[model samples]
Target: MTELALLVQGLLDGSIYALIAVGLTLVYGLLRILHVAHAALFTLGGYVGVVVTNETGSFILALVAAMIVAGIAGMIIYRLVYQPILHLPPYVALIASIGLFIAMQEGFRFYDEQGVSYVNPPVQGTLELAGQTLQLAKIVTFFVAIILIGGLGLLAAKTRTGVAWRATVTMPAMAESFGINIIQVRYINFFIGSALAAVAGVMVSLTTNLVEPTSGDVWSYKALAIIVLGGLGSMRGTLIACFALGVLEAFATTTCVPLGNIQICLGEIMNRDAIAFAFLVIVLMIRPQGLFVRA
Candidate 1:
């Protein structure tokens, strides 16, 4: 029963990671930018949702507004900072992204003054399944991850814009020759990515009941590691890696192992936060291209 509970919680946590990591994956694939500020956009969305919900007393409205604002902010950032350097070396854009990330973080700190705190969603409770309990907010967040991830997958696979996006990523010149507006596709991709991040941010706030300005600082690195572990540009890999890391961390936390004469705790030895990178190192050592990517 205890094991079951851990597994359940892990899956729920993984869903949020997927929601966040998938967006980072999309931006990397489409624009070839590191998007270091992606998680800052996520933290911004959480703050936005908190503010909107406080003002309106409506979680749904807050969710919608956060997504829209984050999406628009993504577009604006691209226009102002990324577009000019789009054709430059990837490293150049990466440095610019780091700068943008810092600016956004500081802006959030300045805007909130005392700093933003958590606002619980209207719904509150837990679900009991076969003797195990699950938080309602987490369940809702998991479902949202599923629906949005599925919807995004369908959009990328079936829609005309989706096709154009694939083409642009693979061969921008050829895609442009085929009449696909690369600039528009770039904007749309960033919008979708940032919007996804917004949803993830709100979910995190609801589940954890805290929204620090630095909330995204840790996640930004984790999401980046997730995409790399899942395979940089492969949405499939990102989703799998999210859950994989989540479950691994859960087990690491709950399970104890013996080493020589001493019992060593995985969580204590590696630390929960470092587990992602530990898995990353192991995966890279085994498959340098990532779990899903082919050489």
Candidate 2:
């Protein structure tokens, strides 16, 4: 039962990672832009959510509002900033995103108060599941993620907007020829993707109960790794890659092996769960098209 308990915890952590990764892949697949600013955007959502929750004490409303604001912000960025660079070289656009990321990072100093220690919110209730204790937040997050994934999958597979979005990925010019508003679709994609990131950010906040500007950067990198590992533009592939990364990170965290009577740290192999990113680099080197690219 103890072993089962640990396994449950690991799966819960992986699910959160998977949610964040899906958002990252959405931005990459739909916009074809490596949004370095996404890290800042993620943190922004969490901060906003925290503020609203504090004032009104409505967690669900705070979550939704955070997503809406972040989504609007993303759309604004796309229309005002990225639109101008759409025709530029990929590397040029990449550089612009880096600039935005840096600016947002520095901008957080405006919110820094003197001597306010970060205190994590205490929603720490445990549930007994089959004689094993598990965190309620983690379990709720996992189910929410599963439902969202299933709904998004259906949206992509069954709806007109989803089809349009997929068509754009397949061939932007052809999608435009079919009379779809390319710019509008881009805005929607950006909005949804960024909103997803915000949702993930809020979920993460529940885990630590603290909000910090730098937190977004950490989540973004994790998402980036999952997006790359999942094979661009394939939602199922992205989910698969997320779980794969999650399991790897979890294993590294929960276990350590003896090497020649020395207890070598598994984290040294993958610190803070960043081994997944290293694996992504190797995968790209070996298969630039991605290991799970949709055929």
Question: Which candidate number has the best TM-score?
Answer: 1
For model 2, what is the error of residue 201's alpha carbon versus the real structure, in angstroms, after optimal superposition?
A: 1.0
lDDT for 107 (candidate 2): 79
lDDT of 2 by residue, 1-295 (tens): 4555656776787787776776667767766787878777777777877777777777888889989988998888788778998888888878898898888767765785321122435355789976877777778888878887788888989999999988887788999999988888888888877787787777777776767767777667777777777777677777877776666666666677888989877677667656667778888999897778865
Show the colliding residue pairs in model 1: none
In order, the Cα lDDT scores of the candidates are 0.86, 0.76
Provide TM-scores for the models. 0.94, 0.89
- Candidate 1 local lDDT, 4-108, one digit each (tens): 888888898899899889888888887778889998989988888888888888889999999999999999988999899877889999999998898888888
In lDDT terms, which candidate is top?
1
- List, in order, the clash count of every candidate structure: 0, 1
Ten-residue segment with the worst summed lDDT in candidate 2?
Answer: 113-122
